[model samples]
Each structure stands twice: as structure tokens, then as C-alpha cells.
Target: MNYIIKIIFLFSICTLVVAEEAIFHKNLKIKKDDTTVNVKGGFKIIREQFYKNFKKENNLDYNFLEVTKKNPRHGDTALELTVGTGCIGSKADCKRSNFESKKRVEVSGRKIGKKDDNVWMSMSLLIPEDFKWGGRLTIQQWHNDIEVYEPMFETDIKNFVGLTMKNGSRKGYFVLDKPNKNCSAGSGDGSTGANFCIKSYQEFKLLNWDELLSLKGKWIDIIHNIKFNSDPNKGYFKIWINGDLKVDHKGQTIWKTHGDVEKYFGKNRWDFKFGIYTTSKMAFKLYFDEIWIKRSCKGLKLKRLGYKCKNLLDQEGGVKPYSIKDISGNPELAGTL
Candidate 1:
């Protein structure tokens, strides 16, 4: 009986390992097609499917999303997300009725990003020629969940980083933030008070938001490599625009809860949201294609584009991770931004 139990236990362990590896392998190529983008936790809430057949067929309920073959980055089809007039702001998933009538049609990857996740993502974005710039538009953001525990003590705050474009300006900037040390229970709401009492907020402006007007009606590739960590020394964020290294910042990329060690810390509590999220009255359209997310750079195949991945040896003192100084000295990444 003991021998038979041991055999069954080993089989179960082997099966679990195989299942884990299969998920990573399958995620390596998250279907590039339009109807099946395979973004886990794609939509937030389903109020009511106005178009029931579309939801049944594609597993997507939004009317603003479509699959087009006009100008795909690599494949035959790309996703086009639009927000037009007469669109009900409350129909979409957002905090407080379209962010105070800001309007949004987003794809939520609410299950992807997590604590201590070394995530790499690459995608191509197109700003249509007729896209009207008005107010603030958040193209992509790495947002954390707002947890209300016990006596209504909100924790883990807002997004740590986002890619934003403003109205009447050709320049774009990255919004980065960390938690406020002085925050306590029953603090201010996230809508006001320095963006939910964010302690460290920095906007790193590198180049044109429109890429010198050359990106209009054209596709520009963007790549992000993020090491999500609350530790100031271990976390790093790197971005490449049009295959050129544009932003490299080292520090905390996510916020942790205030108390407890086992329950609060080391939890996967972050996600990624993309697509047009704007406050402008004018309707806007955007295209996304060639979207890829991976766990490591070993298979990104971006070496031909002059991309280099740093190798860290986590020994006693073997090799340290690349710093801002090292990135600045590299000729391939120096002059572009």
C-alpha cells in the first residue's frame, strides 16, 4: 500500500509540472488574431451585452472593437479600438462612469502582471491621421488593484506607471509613481490630493509624443521590459521606441501593502491595460498589432534590431545588473532619445 501511494504521488507531481510549463509555452504565442487576442481577464464587468451574438462568437462584448486587415504590423489582421460620440460612458469598464465622462475602450490584462514578475511586452501602435488630440489620453498603463480591508483602509493605491499623451502637444511622457509613506487609514480618494497621495511622482520626457509627426498614419513599435519590485535597488524599467532605447529607470515599479508579511507581501496584484482611454470630447481611433508578452528575452528575437538583454548573476558578488550609466554609454541606445 505504501509503495502504491508513493507512485501515485509522484505521478501527480509530474502532471503539475507539465501543466505549469505548458502555460508558459502557450503564453509565448498569445494568438495574434483579432477575435481571439487571448488577453486573460480581458474585460472587467459585463453590465449587459447589447450585441449578444458578438459576445457569443468572439467572447468580446464591446461594439467599438473590430478586426481589420488594412495595415497590420506583421500578420493579416490587427485590432482597432474606437470611442465615438453618443457612446455611453457608463457602458464601459472604468472607475466612476468613464473617469468623469472621459470615455474609454480598453483591453484589460488584469491577470498578467504580478509582484516580482519579470515581464516583457512588445506591440505596435498606430495613431490615425484624423485622430484628434484633446485632453489627456492614457495609451497604456500598469495599474494595481485598490484593496479595501477591515475598517475600510484602502491600500496598494493607483497605477505605478503609464504612457500618456496630452492635447495640443507632440510630446508624450511616462507617469511613474510610488506610495506615500505618510498615508494612513481613511485617506483621501484617488481622484484628488496629489493622485491618491503618491509620494514620488516623475514624468520622464524623452522625445516627441507624435514622433515628429512621422508616426501619424503609421505604425511605431514599442517594447517594454519591467521588473516589478517594491525594493528600490532591484527594480528596473526599460522602454524602447521604434527599436531605440528611450527610457531606462531603476527603482520601485510596484507598491506593497503597509502591514503584515505573509498575506500582504509577495502577492501577484498588478495588471496591464491598453487601448484608447481619453477625456477628450472628440472621438479617436487607434490600431494595435504584433502584441507579444513573454517571461524572458531569450526568444524575443529582437537582437537584429540592436536590442541587448542584461544578464545578472545572483551570486555573492559576481555580476551586477546594468545601471543607467551603462545604458547611457551604449552607442546603440545613446543618440536616439
Candidate 2:
């Protein structure tokens, strides 16, 4: 009888290991005439309660996608692209909406009046309050149309990063233009360098500029690191491109006066919004599959945000396991200690 009991216990342990290992997974499907992908979390939660209780105490890493099916010259078709979201809203008053709100948002694809043969799309996941500084954002793209944006608000904006691209003889990429004291970075004026722009090789080669003056272009797989060292009075900012030293700025100060720093950091305790954006014109298809954000030094740790598993075996009395809602608001057994 004891041997039989031990055999049963071993089988249960093997099943648990399989379940845990399955948590980290992904699925993607593409067709000649259509493109569809679904990202389902291994963990489920209550859709409504998850967002309501979402705070610094319950932070989790979120993912977004930006992909294209075909070259732009093929003409536009009524394509349907689905994105899973907890909430969505308009340009000014965006908020958490229901799953039915999917139709309201536009999918990145071939648009009218563009000379390029590619499509681009962008989505951003807002960082919850109580997030620490110095984290990494990872972007994986199948094609070349992917561009990730990391916006920072320091005493002064430094270490602006952009993407570089080339098409045959045309060449161009993206860059962050400096903003004027009176104007912000998003403004259309020349003062705001194309915070992120794509240049074609044909355009660059035509300039006939010096070799040193010419911009190099090609398909690139790159990662950018934005670092910030902050105190009460000031902050120092630095950016590393593709794991190499690119731009570094120092002696910068924030909240030089009063309320300056508060105004920026007050919103949900997030320093700034970091995400991706695409232009209406692109020559080739791009894909942004997965993105992971974590506190800079500690790596990616989700448990710090009040996510705890219940120790079912070690109950003080006949206590029941605690249930928490995931981002989708589905009820899930709390993690076991």
C-alpha cells in the first residue's frame, strides 16, 4: 500500500512540472491573403477586477504586436488584425474598454497615398505605478518595419535613439529631434527632430554627399537600453544602442523649480510612456512579436507586485487557497509558496 501511494505522488509531481513549464509559450500564424496571431496567457484572471486592482502593488509585464503581411505595392485590402487588450480608447480620452471595443482601433497596414511598399503598426503598454527605474524593453520583429519608442523626461532630454533603414539606393532612418524650451518633442516644427524617422537608401544616395557624411543603411536587429539615475533635485540619463555605447548625457537636473518633476511623475507613478509608432509609408513588412520590461538591475521579477501563491499544504487551520484575477479577470489559484 505504501509503494502504491508513493507511485501516485510521483505522478502528481510530474504533472505539476509540465504545467509550470508550459507557462512561457507563443503562437503565430500567417497566410498569403491574411495575417492572424493570438497571445494567450497561461495564467487567467478576472477581466474586470484585474484592471481595477492594478497598481504598483500588482504589476505584470505586458506585450504588444506590430506586424505586416505583404509589400505595399500589392494595393490595399480590407484586412482584419486582432489585438488583445485590457482596455482601449480614443486619442485624447483613452481608457480601459471592453473586448468588444476592438473595432475602434486601426490596424497598421497599407494606407492610401504612400510611395512605399510596406506596412507598419505600433502599440504601447503603459507602465503601472510603483515601478522602479532602470529596466529593459525587448522587441522582436520578423520583418523590418518594427520601431520601438522609449520616451524619457529628465531635466533635459538626452540619448535620443532612432532606427536606420535602406531601400536599394535610397537611405533613411529615424532620429529624435531636440525640442525647443517653449515647444515639446511631438511638435511638427523643425525643432523637434523626427524623434523617430525612417530614411530610404535611394534618398540618401541621391544626395551625393561625402562618404563620411553619408548614412549607412541595412536591415538591423538591435536593442536599446535607457538608464536613469534620479534624486530629489536632478536626474542623469544615458542610452546604450544595440548593447554598445551610443549616447551619454550627464549633469542634467529635473524639477529645477517646483511642480516640474511632480507633473511628469504624478501620472499613475509612471515616469513616461514607452512603446512603438509607425509611419503610413514603409517599403517592407515588419513584425514586433514580444516585448519584456523589467526593473533595470533586478531583471524581470513579477512577484514584487503583490502577486503571491498560496501554500495549500501549509495552512494554519483549514484555510482555503486565495484566488486572484489575472489581467483578463479570470479567477486563478494564487501561486503556492
Candidate 3:
């Protein structure tokens, strides 16, 4: 406990993914203010201070975000995020409703790090019993990007890397991209220049649906370990659900969108935000709570939610692969993995 294992991020990045079909809702009670009815008023001072710290350090606009007691993961309060349909009559000014608005209750942190750095985050998610449980919903994700102009194709290449989810069976995933040269360009200085292209790394599922669904109607704990701004061969990412390892990937975790990519090597920092994000036009509710970030595995409260995340950081070094240490009813092989 000597190390400060977690830090709270009160992010305020307004991201309204437009042109994409918006969300819809069902029998939920709607307040006179047009918001879906739920718990109100009951805020945690500790959580509020964390939010305030984020505002003071980053100074991002969080007008669309909310922190209330509508629901919580552990304490008397939690963060409730609702993604509403963009059109209902013609009130295009629904805070973040179409005609150019925001999406989800987004909160961004300061930055990932100054390249080749490791960052850890922990939180719990509660998918309300009434949540529209269908289709692919990106409840949470890793994202950071800055566009760059590529002269080779005479077009711009948005160099980006991050994780995404889909098809709603309550799943989480991460996709990898192999950095490869796209094409060669003629250099005015008489040297051939090359552009980069990323080959998709098939599809990597990080969350176990069965284990997650088993805890339905309750808060599910999660921990994300990220190696920031590392190139394809040097980066890594890991995720632990409750107390099980779901993703233990060791490869590039970040890349520059477009630039002299090499000059800023290891200087690029990443960011993250979680809430309801999906292409399905249905009503849904996503709740979040007890989110904290840390620099290493120094002081994270793994057993905070009744279950302990054993074998933590199994991929950091020479840890063995995941296996059933012992089989049930087999006393002979008990204590063996």
C-alpha cells in the first residue's frame, strides 16, 4: 500500500459519433425534462473530487457528462450513461442529439503517457436490468488519434489504434493491425518515400460471455493494463474480468495516426472513455463506477468486489499460460495447474 495504485479521471471529451444510427428506448419512465427516469441526487464527494481534478488538469468541456446516484456499482452512487435516439419530433438540440451533438457520457483523462509507458485502470459496469440488451454495443474502449497527410496516395491516412466491441452477446474484443508500407512515393529530393498500411489482426475477443453473463443484473469488475505508444513489436495490453484473465496480448498497442511517425517515437500518449456506444437504434442503459487509474500493479485493490484477481500481471514477464490449476473432485491432482 505504499504506492499510489489508482488515480481517478474525470474526463470531458464530447464525442458524438454522427451519421451512425442512434440509440432507442422502451418502457422506461421518462421525466418531464425528457431524461429517462431513474435515481436522482446522491453523489459521492470522493468521486466528485476526482472529477474536479480531471477538470482542473485537462480543462476539457464536460457539459454533456453526468455524475449522479441514478445507480452505482458499489457505493450509494454510480455514473449512468444513456445514449438516446437523435430524432423525436424535431428537437435536434437534445444536448447531444443529432445536427452535430455528443454521444454517450464521455470522460477523458489527461493522456496515456510519454511513450513506452504502462498505465492501469480499474472499474465496474452495471448493465441495468432494463437496458436494451441486443446488437453490438461498445460499452468501453481505448482510443487516441491525430490525422496526418500522406503524399504517397495524395490522400490523408488516419493512423489510429484501439479496441472495439460488437454483435451484443455481451462481448469485448481487441483488433490488431500489422504495420506495413502501403506504397512508395517519388521524393522531390530523388529518394523513394514510403507510406504505411496496417493489416487487421483478425479479431481478438477479450471478455468471456459466460462468466460475464453469470453476474448479470450485478456489477462486473474489470481491470485494463495498457502499454502506451509502443510500436507494433514492443507494445502490450491485458485485461482481467472479475478475477480471471481474458486478454493477455503482447504486441504493439499504439501507433501514430500520421506524421514523421519515427520522430515522435515513444512520445505519443493515449486516452480512454466508456459508456453506451452502438450502431443499434434501441434504448439502452450503461452504468459505471469505482474507476481508478494507476502506474503499475503496485496498489490496486484486486479483492475489492468479493473476488480477488489472482495471477495478476501474468504476461508481464515469464509467467506461465492460464490453465486449470486443479480439477474439481480430483484430490490427486489438487494444487496442480
Candidate 4:
């Protein structure tokens, strides 16, 4: 029978190359002018930087970023962000709404510390249950490139940490942006005081939409522990999701130069973007995996990656509060939730 059908078609091509080498990993594929990638101590990451409305003549060639292995929440590959629907934004000159054009795919973090340092980041977010809710979504952000202005109370300083998600009536909340002191003055040109601070921790809710669709397909382990000071009693900003301890928070969190701290000194720091930045004309498919940054948790070795770093960080004092019914323990808290 033709040598038993060539041994069952080469054993079905060696079981599809061992199930695609157990979920893709040909050097962590991510190319499209790959900017950066190299993790595990020596640190480096600034990969897949698309967005300027996915430039290249707005052609969307990279097709909004991908490197999927299906459901990877840890290893083998996972970074699939898609934001389709007019995609315009290079300042959206030919606007079409969605707040005049905004839709993004991100991955930024290449060191921009200083001012008390102490950074730390970790990721693994997956929200696929057919995600599509009204507008305003900004997965994560700690941005502050510079916008200090008080050259005469024309007011436009800055201080705005981020992490948004919205959909009021049909219910879907997850917002955070704490730190308040919206500067209306100070810094006639000395920097660090056009402070348009922020404050919106939306109490945390899960009122409906079937408890926000029971948080779609799962995998949500996030962690961020910053400490860049603007001195709200020595700045702080802690967060941890899946493993609990939601938003420890303290103050300021960062935003110093805008005028002349020696002409923006090291030029204002803070940078750590995440995928999916939306104004939402509806269309998004997010998933990301084991993205990490370290400064501790033994520099995030995480017990050699098997993880059990005791809910992450606490090398003897500070950043406590673990399981309290799983992250902000939902059950109806309103606005900015």
C-alpha cells in the first residue's frame, strides 16, 4: 500500500513539527524593523513600536503587530495587538473622529529613569472574548515626555499616570491615575511645577456585563511598582492584579522638569508603554505575555521563572497586602472603577 502511505505521511509531518515547536520560538519572532528586544537581566526592550497611526503612508503593513502562538500567557510567543478601523493618526490631519483619530499598538521601555528610580514592571494580559466596547481604552501608560508650560499661566504642565478602560452603561471598568495637585502655578522656568496632577482610582467595580464578562479569557497578571519621586512624601505607586494587592499608591509618582532644571536636565523621564491605545471606533484584539522589567524580586528572576516569588516583592518590608479576594475584589464601586 505504497509503503503504508509513506509511514502515514511522515507521521503527519512529525506531528506538525511538534506542534510548532510547542508554540513558536524561533528567536522570539518580532520583526518589522524590530527596534529592540533582549530580556533576562542585561535588559533591553522597545519592540514593535507601531503607531503614528501605523505609519508607512498609513498603509498598515505590519498589520498592527503579531507574534502569536495562540494563547501564550507565559512563554513560546504572545503579543498580538490589532486595532483596525480607519487607523488614522499622525495628528490625524484627515480626521474621521474617534476624538479626531487615535488607535495604537505599543511596546515601549528602554530606560528613562532618575529621580528616585526604583522601577519594576511585569505583564501578562489577555482580553479576548470578542473585545469591543464603546471608546476610551489605554491599556497602560506612565508617560511624561514633557509639556511643562506656565510661561504665564497658559497652564499645560503635566503629571498623569495611566491605565484606562471604559464602557459605562453596559459596564466595564478598570481605571487608575492617582496623584493630585493639578498645578496652576510654580516653575516660572525652573521646572517641576506646572504640575497638572491627576486623581482617578475609580474604586473598582464589577457590577454587570456578566461581571465584565467574567474578565474574558483569563490570564491577567500585572505588576508595576514605581517610585520616581516628585516627593509626595517620597513618591510611590504600586499595583498588582492577578496575585492581588491592587493599587497601593502614595503620591506624585513623577513629573519634574518642564522649563529649566538645567534645561530639562536629563530631559524629563518616565516611559513604559503597553499595547492597545484606543479612542475606539471599535476594533481591538489584545493579548500579550510575560513582558518584564526588573529592579527587584531578585531582579525578577522569579525563582527562575517558575514564579512563586511570594506574590512578588517584599524583601523584608514594604509593598504588603496580598490576597484580598483577588485584586480590588469587585462587587460594585463606581466611576473610574
Candidate 5:
């Protein structure tokens, strides 16, 4: 009898382990890159449900009220909204209220090249303040251009990640200066500009003209290797262009303020902001294939927590109307890390 009871207990333990292990690897899609883990089959984003949750989730608030633009220079379907663009307003006020009310901000169903040509769509997620920054933000576009920005309110500049454009152009520039006053400007030529401060976060500076020219035709990847050291206000910032070292800064200081992080994250801590911003006189197009965010890891074992692929079909078997969860799945798991 005793032996039988022991055997039963052992079986139950084994079954529990198997169940937990299955849950971990069930929706995983692994890649050649040992560090990459494609996520799958979790909480699917139902557009209507998600919009409702966006309002109910008090921890986070999104402002995506649509505005109409009159005599739009573009086609009848001039403006389109994608993932991140919808949340332009919160309970407080419209972040884009400064823009002309007539300048419409709506979601379009058109495709930019092989990708969807959605305009003015922005996505934001509320993470815990103590949540460590992991993974990398990968943005790939085919014919449309995107503007990526990180506004860290509480954390300093060192905690912030910079943006890298691939086969595209970006306008407008802002620099973080001492005290409260910061420098604001636009790109000189029709090229993209990197807005970073060297004094605060070491090596967090814009790419030179020559470096920018080199990455014109090909894809550009910018990885922010953050070093969390003694000073909470200081850290390191490094960038890799096309898998090559481009910018590396040590002992960087990033300003930490309630307003900065709140402006982006709506709470405070670490947040990422990215969108498509064209030149005032002209509109640009760039196609994005993938966008992901990476967190800091010991050694070189970095983990890809979140990623999105373009043109991902939905479960309904249709392709016209798109969504984030349709194509964005967890990186598959070949084995264990």
C-alpha cells in the first residue's frame, strides 16, 4: 500500500512538470539566433475588446481620437491609423491637440508597397516601474517612413533607447540639455536625425553623415547595450548599425522626471515611443517588416520578449483588415534556453 501511494505521488509530480513545461513551449517559435524566442498563442488582441480594455486599464491610458483633415494633399484616403497611432488622447487631453484640427488622423486600409500604408498609428503598453528593460525594437518598412522616439519620464537618458531608420527618412530633432531647457531643431537635409545627449548618457549621440550615408540602402539595426551601475542617473548607451558598431557611450546621464515618462508611458519608468513623421512639405513612405524590443541580459544571452511582423493574416483567413496579434507571435522554442 505504501509503495503504491509513493508511486501515485511521483506520477502526479511528473504530470505537473509536463503541464508547466508544455505551457512554456506550446506557442514558442524558435529561430536560428539562440537568443531569439518568437512568442505565440497567448492573449490575442481583439480590436474592439482591446479598445475597451485600453480605456478600462487604469494603470495605462491611451488617446487615439481620430481627427479629420480638410483638403488633404494625399489621396482621398490620405491618413491611416495603425497600432501605436490610435492612442493620441487620454483622460487628460489630446497629446496631438496642438496639430490642426482639420488635419485628420484616421486609420486606412491601404498598403504601402507590400506592407500596409497605415498612417499615424501609435501603440503603448504599461509596464511596471521595476520592470527591467529587455529585448530590442526592430522596425522594418517597405515604402513608408516611421519616426521612433523614447520618452523616459522617471529614468534618466541612460535608460532610454534610440531609434534607427532603415531605407527611410525622419525629420524634427530635440536634445536634452542641463537644467530644464533643451535644444529643439529639424533635420538639415532630407535625411533622418538622431537626437541624443552625450553628457548625460555616454555615446548616445546621432550618427555622423558618413555613417548615415553608408546605411542608406540597406537595413539598419540599433541595439542599446545599457549598463546599470552605481549612479541610478547614469549608464551607458551603444548602437550597432547593420550589425556593426556605430555609437558607443560610457558613463551617460539621462534625466529622470515625472513628466517625461508620464508623457510616453502614462505611468512612469521605461517606455518606448515610435511613429511615422514625414517632412512638413513632403510625405515619405517606408515599409516595416519587424519591430521588437530587447531587455538587458547577463553575458550575451539577450531575450526577445515582443516582436511584430508585417502583413500577418488573421485567424479569419482574410487579409484586407489587419491586426497586431495576427502576425506577432512569440518566438518559437527549439529546445530550452
Candidate 6:
């Protein structure tokens, strides 16, 4: 068994905004005469319009999603969880909430407006060595619809990014809801159904066992930056692990042509959620922090609020893990965040 990496405590979010896109609006937007878009977190807690951090200890709050301050990755507390289990095969082999295991935490927020631009968000995560490889772990995700004019059941599957873990490895994939010219989402291809769509995973992934073990007990920075497109064939997806750019994909990111898209939702509005969502028999705990979405570093308010930023996050030198060899017998040569 791999040495149980006991990484925990403190978490954060980061979002960058550039002030150049005056055509759009949001927490992070471009100011008049400004060319930079300000970055900020995508989450907005009740009573607090711009929540910089989860500051209160033991004070878990939210609506439509679960919140726990027991196992904080930063600040005085964090979101703690004991995942529920799921089933497979015949119906006889399953039972409970339609035989599904919805064990996870979500930072639920109002649907942001229709957007067809560059969107990015990052979160700090601490997973213990025991977090397992067999469970269905969807640590983070972004869900949106292309039928902005009205809610269309089919469009729900049109675009999404789910950062999932399977067979002991980390993977982030994009599932596009592509319907033909006559393909009314309501009809779902008029045969195969809405679940049928195009899917692609990150090229450079955190799949190396030795690589994951090296950062087991250390806080790893997992980030997702996406460029939403309308052509369903011209967008891009990117990811960074521990400050290292692991996945950089360019191509179609959504499902819609030049005319199918409805008003408002034409550009598309997406819902951002993060936390532990798994189907594991055994209980699991995950710590998350530094949740942010922005256009640049200046858009991030993590440090401005005086929230502690751990310098010892690096697995090796606490600053440069790749510069030397770790005890796990792996040579880390590319971690500097």
C-alpha cells in the first residue's frame, strides 16, 4: 500500500477577470477604457455578495447544497464528508434513492448569465492517501445549457466539464451535447437519447501512480480554465496540477450551431460546483480551498483579505518540488505553485 499521505487543512478559490470585454457583465468584468478583465471567485454566499473565503469556524452555510466546517483545508474550518455508496448491474443488486449514491458537497449558486468567453476557476485540495482509486469521485464540475431562451431537457447534456477519478487516477473530461439541425433536444436524437453525446478527456493527465503518491500528503492545486465556444467545434479546455499545466486542449467545447441556440442562453449560462461527490463503500474526506474564477492573477482576492497562503504546499522544497527527489522514490521536476 502507498504510504498514507495525510494532507489536510486550509483551502482557497481563485478567479481572474480581464477589463477588456465590455460586451459582457459579471462579478469580473472589463471597466471602461480598461483592457484587463478582473478575476474573482465564482461562488456567492447568502448575505455576502463577494465571499473571499469560508472564514467562520464550524459555521457551515448554504442552500440547495450540503456544507460542513469540520474538516477545513484552511481558515478555521473546511467542508468534511463521509461519502455514500452506489451500485451496478441488475436492479436486485441496488436500493436507496433510486439506487444512486449522491455523496458529495456542492457550492451551489445562482445561474450566471449567458456567456461565450474565457472562463477559469481554481481550488486547493488535500486528499489523504486512503482516498482510494475505485470510487466514483467527481471533485469538480461545470454544467450549462445552450437553449438560453427556455429550459430544454436535451440542452442539459449539451455542455459540461466533470473532473472525475476512476481506477486510481485523475481525469477531466468534456461532454458536449451535440444535436443535429433537426435534433430538438426534446427529442434527444429522436432515438439514442440525450445521454448520447461527444466526450473527450485531457491529454496530459495525473495518471502516474508514482506521481500521485509523491503529492499524496501535500496540498495540490487543481485548476480548470475553459473557453466556451458556439460552433461545437472550436473551443478549448485547459487544466493545471500543482501549478503545472497538465492538460491544454483546443477544440469544440459546446453543442450548438449558428442558429439552434435560443436567446439569452444563446451564448450559454453555466453553473459551477466543487466538492466531494463519490460512490465509494468506504467513507472519504476531502479538503478544498482557494476557490476562484477570473481572467488574471490581479482578479484573485485570496491574499488581499489576509487569508493565509501556505508556502509549504510544495511536496519537496515547499517551493520547488521538482528540483529534488522525494522519499517515495520519485523525481519531481515540475511543481512551483
Candidate lDDT scores, in order, read 0.48, 0.23, 0.41, 0.46, 0.26, 0.38
Candidate 4 per-residue lDDT, tens place, 97-193, comes to 2223444555555545454677776666777877656555566566544433211000000112122221111111123242111231122322223
TM-score: the better of candidates 3 and 6: 3
Off by more than 4 A, model 4: 1-60, 70-77, 80-121, 124-141, 144-223, 227-229, 236-252, 256-272, 275-288, 291-305, 311-337
Tell me which of candidates 5 and 6 scores higher on lDDT. 6
Estimated TM-score per prediction? 0.58, 0.26, 0.52, 0.27, 0.32, 0.49
Better of 1 and 6 by lDDT: 1
lDDT of 6 by residue, 1-337 (tens): 2333322211111111111211112322222222121223334322232222321332323222223333444444333333334321122112222234333334433555344667666566666767655534666556554432211101000002122221100111122254222111222212221322222222233434556556555666665556765443556666556555555555545444334344523355555655444445544556555566665434554353333224212222111111122222221211110
Once fitted onto the true fold, the runs of candidate 2 whose alpha carbons sit more than 4 angstroms away are: 1-234, 253-285, 297-337
TM-score of candidate 2 on Cα atoms, chains taken together: 0.26
Q: What is the lDDT of residue 295 in candidate 4?
A: 68
lDDT of 3 at 290: 68
Q: Across residues 139-241, which tens digit of lDDT does each residue of candidate 2 receive?
A: 1211111112112221110111222211111111223242221212222222322223222111011111232122222111122222322232233223222
What CA root-mean-square deviation does each model show from the true structure?
Answer: 15.9, 23.5, 17.8, 20.0, 21.7, 16.3
A best-first ranking of the candidates according to their lDDT comes to 1, 4, 3, 6, 5, 2
**Tens-digit lDDT track for model 3 on 1-337?**
3233322121212223221112111211122332222212211121244434544565544322344555566555455555455321111112221122222334444344444567776777776666545556556545432221111000000112112221110111111132212211111111322233222222334433554455557877767776754455666666666656656656556554444543542223454545554444555556677666667655455455554445675434322322212232342331121
lDDT of 1 by residue, 1-337 (tens): 9999999999999765433311112322234344324344443321234333434554532345555657777656666766665333443322332134445555555466666778777667787888666655667666554332111101110122223221110111111243321222122232321112233234443234444355578777777777877675887766666766655656666665544422632343566666665555667777777665677765454553345554211112211221112222333332122
What's the lDDT for candidate 4? 0.46
What is the alpha-carbon RMSD of candidate 2 to the true structure? 23.5
